[model samples]
Target: MSDTAPADWDPRSPKVLDNQIQAYDEMRHRCPVAYSDYLLWSLFRHEDVMRALTDHETFSNGASRHLSIPNAMDPPEHTPYRRIVEKYFTQEHIDEFEPVCRANTEALFDDLPPEGDIEVMSALAQPFAVRNQCAFMGWPDSLREPLRQWIGKNHRATRAGDRQAMSKIALEFDGYISEQLILRREAGEEAPPDATTRLLHEKVEGRWLSDEEIVSIIRNWTVGELGTIAASVGILIHYLAAHPELQEALRQGHENLPEAIDEILRIHAPLISNRRITTRAVTIGGREIPAGERLSVIWASANRDEDVFGDPDEFQPQRNRDNNLLYGAGLHVCPGAPLARLELQVFMETLLAKVRHIELSPDTTPERAQFPASGFASLPVRVQRG
Candidate 1:
């Protein structure tokens, strides 16, 4: 193990944080495997990130101090938990939840002003994510506000790298889920038949899942659903607003929504990066990373690699579909992708069908979210009714 690698970049610097995608693009070309204090060995190139993902033996996912279900687990141990997570995102489950997702999206769309300036993040993106998550999990409407606030706090703690605040925020989230579990336990047979209740009855390796495990699973789902989903909505809308031709194309017939959403997100990633720890000393992009070293696979950059895609910003869904790492790759790929895809597809379809045109707000510029988060923090747009 060598600790001789000097810092090549600062991930938290104003220049990088102000425009993460551009900074990552520059990093991928300049230093594919750059070392930084905040992210350690950051893998920016597509090839390097893919290698870490595929070679889980050399690059492990057990990078978190806290138990993160299958997200932070590696192999043999990761398989069963991953299987359990996959079950909830099956075609059958996603199909069943489609109507609920559409209804929630439609309800949110109905609340948008008929024709005027509006903030996409608040007016549509955040509420749509929160409502869909609550509806899917069988959580109450009351949780909508709390979860929204909790996600903001979680992002703030993460960006600040405040371990105590992060831990405290995590406990607060667990408390929210714990109350739901307690309610179901007290309800006995009358307990709501929701995902949360179903989780209580899930058996892993012949034993009922512990409260801690259940809370962890639910926490993972909640975080992914709230953060990524919200960020994605903003990105999708902002991209369309900026490109009226593509916006009109989709608005005419959104049958191409699934493919289009994937492509757009590839250009402007919603999820910035995922963490991994080296299990053995390995040389990647000519840099030697020792065993147990922490690394970040920058999806925000890798997906937009010019080597993989001729023009990183070009809108070519069919061309880029094969190599798109929007949901990631390898064994630890996102388990909730099916549900996420379905929700985004439905939301986009509804948005296009309802609003005739979506344009950037005349006076306000969209505010980009900082590290540990991606997409816009605030997206101001003007909507014209059909």
Candidate 2:
């Protein structure tokens, strides 16, 4: 029989879910490594998460039962697929995608009202994510609405920990991606030249990637770009709206946008956590666990670690950038970091270009997103256009 530690904290408690970041902040100070039935074992400190990240042998990424392509694979298998993914996110591709990303951002801005209060999620953040992903993948505009709805269903299922619902939601998204693959294959040379079509030609270990593999790749991209991007947009804007001096400084000098974006996200993570599992028995933050138990690497907590960042909320982009696990570290560092950076930089630039000021709406306070996700659920804000 395997040794199992008693529960250290309840992840499903109403308090934790109600305000995830604050709860994580408390947990990081109180019990760096905590256990709950839902998460099994959760590493809340920067040191613990980094150890799990850098040492892949002891801390494995093959935690998901579903096929996760490169992200879910280890070493020998993970290497080649990761190489393929890296190619798509190269600076060249990022440069090529900039104009399209900019045009999409501009079009979305046109829909925003010139001066009054706005529900940024529906008005801007959510739609921007859907459009950016669809445009980059060469998906049709018709898909924008369905994909938006899919993100809602996906988040609801994830938060509920409903495996059955999660499986169905995954399939529902797979079907959407599968149809695109089919269309590209049917069109042959006439198919739209986009990321989705390009993946059809990706080779792994001298063998063409299978349909299932391609879907998994796109699924990773959609989840990365849509949900996280939406959350990020809200977080970035919210941070700026709350800090007028910082917002004005950013507006005055557009060059500081990228570092500023990373720093803000470090304060409020767009992604709450990622999963890992122990290949063998190990101890983390003095908590013991047996082999094969799952672990939750809580990014939200790790990034804000007081030991690393001093004052977790203090904005120190240059000092904290090296330690920020925003994209992660080691073997599984996000391959799409370049693309994510470019998307965010352009988004901030476009907004700051036309909007003279951004302030939180006094009419309705922003609603915090629940566990499994971060950032505001509904952000009502006032933006003054120049």
Candidate 3:
């Protein structure tokens, strides 16, 4: 299906597809506000990206151009749903999730076959990342495979722009959540101190949420987290293996693991681009963007803008500035960022503590996922005991 991208679609090149940050930087400098027949206008500058995000009213989130969320809805209506989810993704909840995530990471690492080929994506990153979400939501372990498959189908549907497929999978996941809600209701209790419970109990639009809204909220979490986290972790692990010095540095200062994780995330910026429908005609970066048309703000590109970051391509874990749009910006910035940070920190700390060495397999190359989500299908590598 469309493996060869249009010439103007910069990041779609085979080489750049694998290394999105590099490709995004190259395109930003050459065509900051580029146009493709398919994706309309793409904005790449950091300041421009910031402006678009902050001006939420003009770039309304409920444009029906994309799926549900505060990501797709403006303020007033957006704020309440965001607040409901924000409470669950708070610093306290993230801290609570740390131990379980760490344990899972370590267990997966321990189980990897040593001194031979192992596809880290399947054996470690993919499963561990999804299971981490299950742990966070307190979902039954029985639902893991089904949820993972749902995630895959949902991702595929989104890329294909198949609304019917999206609705189908949405209902499938929603049905599962509905059953869970039934079980929780039978117990006549709130959610078990996790996102699900918070969704079940919280009010969205001046009243408690319905089962559909709760399921949609969980869908947002799974879509926002699962694949992107897995991809970022896979890429981070590959980098760590290639750069043993960095891995050693991280191992020595486990305290700086969080900082290290942030920097790595900044470098990779898992999800490639976010789409926003322009409410009014706006001229940005010398390009005229029309109202009601969609524009993509490339987070990967903005993170590497020379204006925002010096030597932008280099990986410097201790960079003190917020130059990256990895977590996005302004009104629609990712609310689940704190939880994501916690997961990354715990995973890195546990992985470093458990493994003596990590090396890429000779015949292995990661296969990047389709658009919306930038990640790998398989990341094969080898692990040595600590």
Candidate 4:
């Protein structure tokens, strides 16, 4: 956006950041097409966000300076890379990984006290997110702790808006991915037949993908999947703890676990927003946005827009299923939806099987994560296995 453009609101302001969902709710109604210094052009309404998602020509995903695989590409460039990504998350692969994902969940739960208080973010959400991500990529057990710590540093840098720090952190993540690529190459035929190895030989437009491109793809997967999965876990458990009647209902017969998880996440989105750059001048929500400006699709706001979902907070899974943007829509939809859904369902099924009840602590509230992240930063809950 031009520096001279008038600022409509501050996305980083205390009023907005303190309670992001509520702030966004207000924004969607008051000013759907909002402009700010931090987020150049932010679309808060469901209709406008949907327009941007479907119209790739006007709102291009090639917004990032660095390479970002299919997530940052548009159309022809995005198609083949997306195909490679989809293969890894196919039903066959998800079915194959289910047992492994469950084992990781069970091991994590085993460390928790049988009938006592636990911080769900650290004890349950983050660890399982990190470990399961590693397992999916066939990364070794050693990467689990480092990746967990790295996510913290990355989040801190992002919230601080520290460009140099973010760049360094990006390089740090690239290093981890690049090293794995090296090991796979060195092992040749002996390399484990994991997603990383398969990516090594993936072709697009009759050419092998560069090492840089490979690293970019894995980086997107690791960061996106890990953060959102962790947030989803926290949100799911916190919701269950807060609504015991529904929780008990599902625990008794978990056939609704998949639907319940989707509805809960839609109400409190795990992934907050994604970015784009305008390919040409466009008018959205009665506001004219010039070409070459940054655009942010506020998924958190769009999914909760009262116009579409009736009451934003109503837990109507079956009713909201068709319109839920949990995994997004159109050409740029998340390729790993199958794997992510499988992981969450398996994790919750295992948790419900092992634990008798989940309840939020009477004295503590799960601290909300700040902007750029959704869900609890620290979630305290009482778990009873007896």
User: Which of the predicted structures, 1 or 4, would earn the higher TM-score when compared with the native?
Assistant: 1
Candidate 1's error at 358, in angstroms? 0.6
TM-score of each: 0.98, 0.98, 0.91, 0.98
State which candidate, 2 or 3, has the greater TM-score: 2
lDDT digits (tens) for residues 204-282 of candidate 4: 8899999999999998999888999999999999888889888888888944889999999999999989999998999
lDDT of 3: 0.75
lDDT of 4: 0.90
Better of 2 and 4 by lDDT: 2
Q: Per-residue lDDT for 223-257 in model 3, tens only? A: 78887788788878877887788889888884377
Candidate number of the best lDDT: 1
Worst 10 residues of 3 by lDDT: 1-10
Task: Give the Cα error of residue 76 in candidate 4, in Å.
Answer: 1.4
Q: Kindly give the number of clashing pairs for every candidate.
A: 0, 0, 5, 0
**CA RMSD per model (angstroms):** 1.1, 1.2, 3.4, 1.1
Model-by-model lDDT, in order? Answer: 0.92, 0.91, 0.75, 0.90
